[model samples]
Target: MASFQNINIETQIPEEILIAQIMQLHESISKLESLRPCKQVNSLFTRLVKLCTLPSSIDIEALPQEVKEMRDSLINLSGHAEGLLEFEFSTFISLTPEPFKNVTLFPYYGNYVKLAHMENKILKENGMVNAKKVAFVGSGPMPLTSIIMATHHMESTHFDNFDIDEKANEVARKIVASDAALEKRMKFVTQDIMEVRERLGQYDCIFLAALVGMNREAKVKILGHIRKYMKEGGILLVRSAKGSRAFLYPILEEPDMVNFEVLTIFHPTNDVINSVVLLRKPKA
Candidate 1:
């Protein structure tokens, strides 16, 4: 592996080497349950992160067509493997009596803990007390954020986990089914976020997952749908990326959020992968 210390990232590094490493990372993510190569995954990811953040010299759009294509490929494949990791664990946890017992086995468990704290802080500062209902859009197989909020943060708040995939919804349901109390407060729905329009107004807060839309244009459309259907005063917490983190997730820009008032954006400088933007739908 070549040093990424001070060269033009786009030109100095051989494209073949970069592609090979990325494919290796993808494979590593797939076999995380068995392989669990923590150190290797961390090193590769950190280098790629630095590569993505190297000064304007790494103008992605101006790069060679092949490299540009690889850049997109890296983002899409990384997101796919991330979901794959979650699904793998979700299936395992669904079978266990205590779903969270093995949660720390996942490399990104701390990230979820950080997100839960961030959500609690944002909701508290905004006087969002005893939220009647909260909806988490694009909630995948392991609705950890929702589960964490239900048990640790907002004990009384009811959560609706929405996913487009039926199998994912089934697994999520099973994960929450073991706890009788959580089973009462958490519900998993196998429906697209776009189809939840009629029931959107009932939610006091809505969370947009990181992988909901893989690109900026798609994110804009999904946010538009959320804003159109949700209540005027509803809070929308969107998972986004900043700086190096953009390599793994789509970055949501302010210009795309025309109608929503940005309350606060928390960009964690730590291990948290996604930057959270807390917004509210302004009254018409």
Candidate 2:
């Protein structure tokens, strides 16, 4: 009986073997998401940490060179996860800047760019506190992803989408209405934000994506509406392709706008500039 117990203990797995397995898992995740490689790899590594905690007999020091290589990949992937998210968001949103759609500079694409930046900024700043009742102004050419992410954060929220362009409004409406996550909470309206200022006060948060390059007068007018629509203690977020510091001058004076500001200026991810401005409303 003693001899059998000794044999069983000796046959147990080694820590080194477990580490090698972890490395392979990380590599597999990296391969899955070529664009979001780092995040995928990190996620795999996280899972490996859990697996390695098992009471195994593998020797940690016996890991092969290939396993070491995997460790290197994990480190590199973890280091760049944030940078990758930023780049992905920037390139996706402004695929088509103001002007002719076919222009090479303004390549029409999906809604990830705008949605990613806005969601990232708002979540990081507000920390998901009282994130209900969202209002989106100027739902742009593609705001499906933006509205979708917003619905995820807000609790039992209502989405009010306001847009002046009939075609743009239709596109956003179709996108929102089609999304099961947003359809229950979202409402789309084809109305100039300026004309609907009085009706906007009900929302707890407001999003303004790509309000740049419009006529200067129009920009100011829209800002006025945003100021009116945002609730006290709510949040107002803005994204722009130009990404300049001058973007916040128009609405800074609203007495209710929070003083702590978040300025996000990321390098062009694909071919588009990524700029974001986040302002929280005062609690009073």
Q: For every model in order, what is the number of clashing pairs?
A: 0, 13
User: In model 2, which regions exceed 4 Å deviation?
Assistant: 1-118, 128-130, 151-156, 179-181, 212-217, 241-272
Best-performing candidate as measured by lDDT: 1
Model 1, C-alpha of 235: deviation from truth (Å): 0.5
Indicate the TM-score of model 2.
0.47
For each candidate in the order shown, give its overall lDDT on alpha carbons. Answer: 0.76, 0.49
Per-residue C-alpha lDDT of model 2 across residues 163-269, encoded as one tens digit per residue: 66666555445544444655677777887676776666776667775543143345555665566566766666765432111111112222323343443333333
Off by over 4 Å in 1: 1-68
Per-candidate TM-scores read: 0.81, 0.47
